[model samples]
Target: MNSFSELCSLLNQVSSADYKKILLKEYLDSSTDSDILWALYLLSGRKLRRSFDITGLWEILPKLAGLPEWLIDESYQISSDKAETISLILPVDPDEKRITLSEMIKFADDISELPDSAELEKIINILKSINAEDKLLFLKLITGAFRSGINKKDIAAALSEKYSITIISAFHFLSAADPYEDNPDNLLKYYKRNKKIFSSYPFCSAQNQDTASVFQGDCKQWLAEWKWDGLRVQVIYRKGELLIWSKSGELVTEKFPELFRLSQFLDDGTVIEGEIIAFSKGRPLHFSILQKRLSLKTVPVSLTDDFPAALIAFDILEFNGNDIRSMPLTERRKILASVTEKSADQEIMYLSPLLEFKSWKALAEIKNSAAENNCKGIVLKKKDSAYSGNDWLSLNLEPYIFNAVLLYAQRSLNSEMYSEFTFGAWHNDELITFTKTSGGLNEVDLIEISDFIKANTIEKFGPVRTVKPELVFEIHFEGISESKRHKSGITLRNPRIHRWHKDKKPHEAGYLSNLLELLNAGK
Candidate 1:
């Protein structure tokens, strides 16, 4: 426990990527296999299930520390982190012994199966056995809020360097094998095998580039397709079983049962890369419709009928138990077209249509009409580029912008100062809340806004403060839609603060009717 806690502290203090790799390799070399596996699991941004509710911790802390509840709350307000607050206030024992990371994981797993009272008792005893630093990590683990600066890429790079293998091989191994369940020997075997039934290849992400630069060469060298706004997925069919893996490496086979029919058209050991969209009536619906299908564990027949799911296949990574990622895009596209042609009659699958353009100006004109066709933009891939090559580019539409007045402010969980702000647009005679954003501001702007929030408060509701609507901001968003859930009868997608509108008056802010007009125009 102490060693793991020390490693976490060291990782938090460093910012250099190369230095982080060195630290991870050193720790991996010195730690036991069990400890190494657990470390990778946590450092790669995967968290264990919360064994107990966080509110339970607040109740237990006041009793354990013999401190007033109000004082604890005040400290929490300042630190803005529960683990840090609890670790600071808890009483430390000089004779406490350290436990191994594997032992700590076992304790958490064991207590999750116990009754509420028994779990609480075991938690208290364990908390008392560890020092304050180790307790912070332990509490973070149990609460499922563990975070280290390192990411999956860093871990894979470390392993690649250590074992003298390609980074892609490391990524495939990590994605296929569950660190929590697989032992060191099993992990080695899987790495050696290099391929598994449910394993996903490292996704090839496109680089964002302007139209001029992307099309500077001969336009015929690039193949364009409409960039669909949907969840990126890889559908795998192997050994008569079908599995769906999201871009984040999550297994989501059961979420969209409508996709199960795809197995009939796919051959054994075939893996098709595509977007899972909420498609109906021969057109793609808004992304919010697809979001509704994601949360339910089981899809009812009626729900599936209303918001049917479909795959717009983009490429093929494997064909008939063979990896084809090394093939050029032109060759791979032929193979993909042939495979998807078998499912032409099926509504659940379709090939993402390739766009025809002879010049950059022609492609730009096509991009201008993308939103009306329910596409984000166009994707351009070099005709002869390999799947593993970095030759793909995405040219997206400019985000819609609106001038809105600041209406509310709130302190974020990571900072005591006011960081989150709600903005509103005019609706007839009143300003109605339309969106909120916490990003796109520098340190100076954040401090200035915090001061404004403090001085112009109109009312307070818990952590949120109703602010005087005097400041205006330029808000940018991807899309807008009318919704009954919002008080303003409207919502914006991916809204963020574009800039502080220092020169604009609050009364000059955009009206809700303008946003509604834009929404209707897209439809």
Candidate 2:
């Protein structure tokens, strides 16, 4: 428990990824398998099964420490944390020995089985034996509020380095690790096997091909497909078994049993990459409908009948017991068309449509008009590129750039960093606020903007500073829709500052008419 507490303290101090990895590596080397497994389970954001609920803590803590409600509230307001306040006011006994991690969990379970009076007394006595840090940790564990700033991937990376395994294998192993079912030891065995037969390959990402490059290349050498607004999934059927993995590497087979039912149609040793979308009356439904289905742990028969999940198999990674990732995409598509053709459920499973364009001009027109077909955008892939190749580009038509005026800037809590800025557009002589952007600014730009904001401050209100509406910024966004909550009466999806439009004036910025035109045009 002391070593675990020390590790947690060390993790909180370092901000560097390299330093965090070093600390984790050192801790892993010194700890036993049981201790390391417990640490990893906590680090990966998993908590113990609740043996007791601490819902009454607010009432219990004040009485236990003899602190008034007002003092506790004031401390919480200042510290911005409840756990820290409880730990600070609670009485401590330094002479008592610390309990082991396993003992702590066992103690909580044992106390939970007792009556309320005995349980409360046992908890208070246990808290007295541990330090403030461990007390907070133990309480968080029992209450299921444990969290660390460290990324879960870092834990996998550290373990991979320690065991001399590939990062991907380590990631999959970590995903399957669970302490309650004795899964940590099983994960070590799976790591030893290193089998990726049914494991989904890490998704291949596309780079943004500039307009110049798109025009410079011949259309015949490229393949175009609609970028479906749905979840990307990989379906694997092997050894009379089925598996579905989301792009994030989550096993989602159990969530959609309707798609899992299609496994019988596919042959063994087949793996295909595709999109999971909701369909109704032979048309793809809105992505929001698919999201509703995803949120359900088990899809109801009635909802399944209504939404009817479907998959558009876009690419084939494996076919008939052989890995075909090295094959050219054109060849793979041919194989994919043939394999999916063997399936009986054509309505639930089919190949994605391949757009035919003669020239870049024609493709651009298709891309601009994609919204009419409810398409998000278009993907361009080199015909000769392998299925595993990274030579693919995604271009969206809705997210067109527009010039906007910077209306306000907000300062960061800790530093003088100008973290967020409110942007607005001219709405018939009024500078109405629409969206706030906090990212996509370089350090130099931030400093320049910060200095300009300080020199031109007009008014101050809390963290927000109203500056002279003289700064114009070129904002890039995804789409515009009517929004009553915004002062401009419209919402800009994912607005980000592209660059400082120093050459433009506030009066010359965008207007409500222009935004309405965009909304009407459905661009």
Candidate 3:
């Protein structure tokens, strides 16, 4: 097999998530060969896709990090077309046999017998000759990430152990490596010595309280956030490198480039967590504004001017090599505030506003005005609280709203037969036989629906089975519109549950015809 194919095979097997540490562990003992490096590149992701097939040396090179098309080309058209040629230069065979991960490692070593360093350089240079389209794939191959398995956290740890450096340092090293760049093998086991408590820290949620008065008495300090309509991002600047990850644990450094610029003002090894909101000069931008920016693999210059993101620093997890997640919110606040550079921050950053509502009544009053001030709601933190559970309550989950769907029944994707209760809806039409329905069920109602599905499975559609639609579920939606995709061709906009009806009848529900009438009436 060709060296690149062997590398690809190795990457495909190692699980993109697990390969970082695994590669460090296996290759740390001695210097790596070209084939080994190639495997890393392919594993990292050396193909444009299953299509655009540049499986060869093209996938492992880095692109011009900060260049814009306008600067490179006088006519935007020429630059756009030429951009595709990048993939052409980094060619992989659609018809060629692909190798396996195990074979890839062995072949890398075998190819290592060749003019070792020269082959590695040759691969990297080949990658550079290609256009930007293939650089990511090229780097993935060289780095031994097939982009299929393995998580990056493990990879960082492996790098730390192999290089005998800090975990944050190892992340930087991996991110900075050139494709076909090889490091030592024993990297995995080497970095496990400094494990910190990444244990859960959160505020209590409103769901847990279940009382209108729960917000009335605060045993501890309390804070309020708008639950801003954006992403929960964690920015970790470690060892002269910057990484920004999302709540889902996906490293989204490239997704938002502007945030990375914070390294210029913040501590190199500090790790911070907060909400990342797309904003205008000084105001919170709409979710759509952020959505447009997020779609880009790299934010564009136009977007930079239009929608910039600012980190609303909420909590400090680590500082100066110390893991402080275990520290109380009160303590973390002190460290977080101390570290905030007065002159270093741009308009994109600001401290989250906090307040102590003397009573739940006060909190409710503030919540009424929160929308006008771009806040989600009031967050209550009990006095003397320690970070605890996985459900932010483990840390302490202040009553927060997370919109989820009821995925069963006629409206749900899972339990069509789970609930026997017929759902209720107001008549959407006055002039038609069917009724339109929506915007009734809230998140709680959906959970009730899910429970009904899970506990009462009977029939099956793929992995989903039926118990009964005995539970009448009303789907709450942001808006409703007619759709061809659904049965009535009536569509829901961001629909979730409004509430579960425990005391209502199914036929009393709004019919499709009634819904159409309502839509007409609203119009």
Q: How does model 1 score by TM-score?
A: 0.64
Candidate 1 lDDT tens digits, 1-523 = 2388888888888767777888888888788888888888778666776646667777778988999999999999999998889888988877787777888888899889898878777887888888888888888899888888776668787877887655544655555556577886677665556446646788888888887777676888889999888889999898776888788655667778888988989999899999988876878987777766675546688978988888999999999999999899989989999988998887888888999888889999999888877778899999988886388999999988899999999987658688789998899789999888888988898889899899999999988999999999999888877778889887788899989988889899999989889888866
Clashing pairs in 1: none
* Sort order, lDDT high to low: 1, 2, 3
Top lDDT model: 1
Q: Name the 10 consecutive residues with the lowest summed lDDT in model 2.
A: 190-199
Q: After superposition, how far is residue 454 of candidate 1 from its true place, in Å?
A: 2.1
Query: What are the lDDT scores of the predictions, listed in order?
Result: 0.83, 0.77, 0.49
Instruction: Please identify which of the two predictions, 1 or 2, would achieve the higher TM-score against the true structure.
Output: 2
- TM-scores for all predictions: 0.64, 0.76, 0.52
Off by over 4 Å in 3: 1-177, 184-207, 211-213, 218-226, 286-296, 324-331, 343-345, 356-359, 383-472, 476-523
Error of 3 at 170 (Å): 9.4
Span of ten consecutive residues with least summed lDDT in model 3: 393-402
